[model samples]
Target: MGQDTKYIVGVDLGGTNIVSLLMNKRGEVLERDARLTLAKEGRERTISQITGSVSAVLEKGRELGISPDSLLGVGIGSPGPLNTKKGVIHFAPNLPGWREVPLVEILTQKLSMPVFLENDANAAALGEWWKGAGRNTSNLVLFTLGTGIGGGIIIDGEVFHGAWDTAAEVGHIIIHEEGLLCNCGTRGCLEAYASATGVVRRTVKAIKEGRETILTDWVQNRLEDITCELVYKAAQKGDKLCSWIVEETARYLGVGIASIVNILNPEVVILAGGMIKAKDLLFKPVREYAKRYALKDAIEGVSIVPAELGDDAGAIGAAATVLKRKGLL
Candidate 1:
């Protein structure tokens, strides 16, 4: 390893998977490693998995003849409510036993490098802003629409972390006054209607209500087999039943995002996550509804696009934060 060689590590800590990356100054991903988070095993185990992944990426970099001895830092993208400045996860609903873990301090001690932390969604937004779909835009809003919706806001070039670090929670915005209950224990949240979980829930409810659908038969009457993807497939097959469900989901998302556009008027709205694979099926309704709901002047030329980085957004964004912090971006 050369003394002047510079590198940095990025970790995306998810409930199911932990991904690490070794990135160079030119923003090329030199090496990557991913492993199960095993979060249920407890905090120490999860952190160990993350650090091990980071080390594995670094080792892979070495195998590729990249002797980057001067590691700039390690950056972590974690599910929040987290104190980004203090580097503690106050509480992350996805990970059990992760209450107030001093992640930055612990990882720095373990890896012998400075560590920085950011909320995973915010990191993804930063990632998209730095190198993905939002590169051409200044004010951007991102929505990760999966099991639940995660939002990130970038105003100008910086993340909009509110006074309490809870800004840009676009998912929790109330769209329905008395709509479905959300996992957050709130009624009528955008997440309740827009998320993949919400799509499945709505499908199952329709099936139970005796609404005829191809999905019920496709899953062989096994309600659990119907997922958001299956719903999209069914819709693609021109199955009217599932098509309406997916359209309604997009409607929910569009209306939710409409609130964001009306309030902040971001230059671009990036929709990410597995659900985005639905492509036109998802974007069409979202755009239509958003245009209808948001102020015309607010959204005239705002681009609503899919995230380009996909799963890499979080990790890259985490690392990007380090560069951004050093003013190296």
Candidate 2:
């Protein structure tokens, strides 16, 4: 692929879904498809699912004047603890069957195209840096606050993958020492207090403690059906308990981000994920607390913003990885 290369493929691999996009160098997605990851079906089956989705998207692209051979390459953003240099998913806590899977090598061999891979959060950061909120800056940090908190750092205009490809595991930042048990078997990690699961856990714990709130009624006294969305809605309706839950989560989130600022001092912090849809409910407290904790010199000129690419960030970033490797981005 050269400067004039017109098409590339982006694949976003998640615990629950696999989304593929056929896109041009200009960032316009010409075709797309998404399906259940079914990772439990094991490594080979998941790989087949991903390749099938990519083929479907390419078929759609074929309808748009681009032939199969016209494609430049394929890029993927996958759940980590992986080695980008080796193109392997070292391990994914949420992906049951994934352990040291040589994903990029397999995909490259099967697709017969140059294939690139990065952690999904890192890919989202690259996507945002290339085409979304971080577009104007050379240094940026992106924290994806979703099922789990995932982060990526861009320094001097490039993704910093670190020596062992494990540099930016921001979610594992320990905040409260032994405060709460995390999915990773650690205590008091930022993910325990800020993710969707964390939010729900906090709310349920509050309800269990006999704290009076609208969430109790909203969930019909059943904690199993409670969600972060339900809690946010209750907060919006003036529920003090729910509001406190969100505000407190934001504070923990802010502390985690402030630590990043103190260390990396990136241009901006981009917060992404479904929970961020609450907008000010989450951003306001995070800024307030982050400002209180981060260094005056380090936090200066740094701003917090939500991701602009929405759900397409993964796919776009996946493509951007290939483009960057090819010196086209």
> What are the models' TM-scores?
0.95, 0.95
Clashes of each: 0, 0
Off by over 4 Å in 2: none
Q: Which lDDT tens digits does candidate 2 get at residues 1-329?
A: 55555789999998889999998888888899999888888887889999999999988887877888878899999988888888988888768878889988899889888898888888999999999999989999998887788898999889998998887889899999988999889899999999899999999998899899987787788889999888888898889999999889989988998999999989999999998889998888899899989998998888899999999898899989888888987
User: Which whole-number lDDT from 0 to 100 does residue 126 have in model 1?
Assistant: 93
Q: Work out how many backbone clashes candidate 2 has.
A: 0
Q: Residue 191: error of model 1 in Å? A: 0.3
Candidate 1 lDDT over 33-149, as tens digits, reads 999999889888998999899989988888877654578888899998998889999998879998889999998899888899999999999989988999967899999998889
Task: Kindly report which residue pairs in candidate 2 clash with one another.
Answer: none
Model 1: how far residue 192 lies from native, Å: 0.3
RMSD of 1: 1.9
- Could you give me the TM-score of model 1 versus the true structure? 0.95
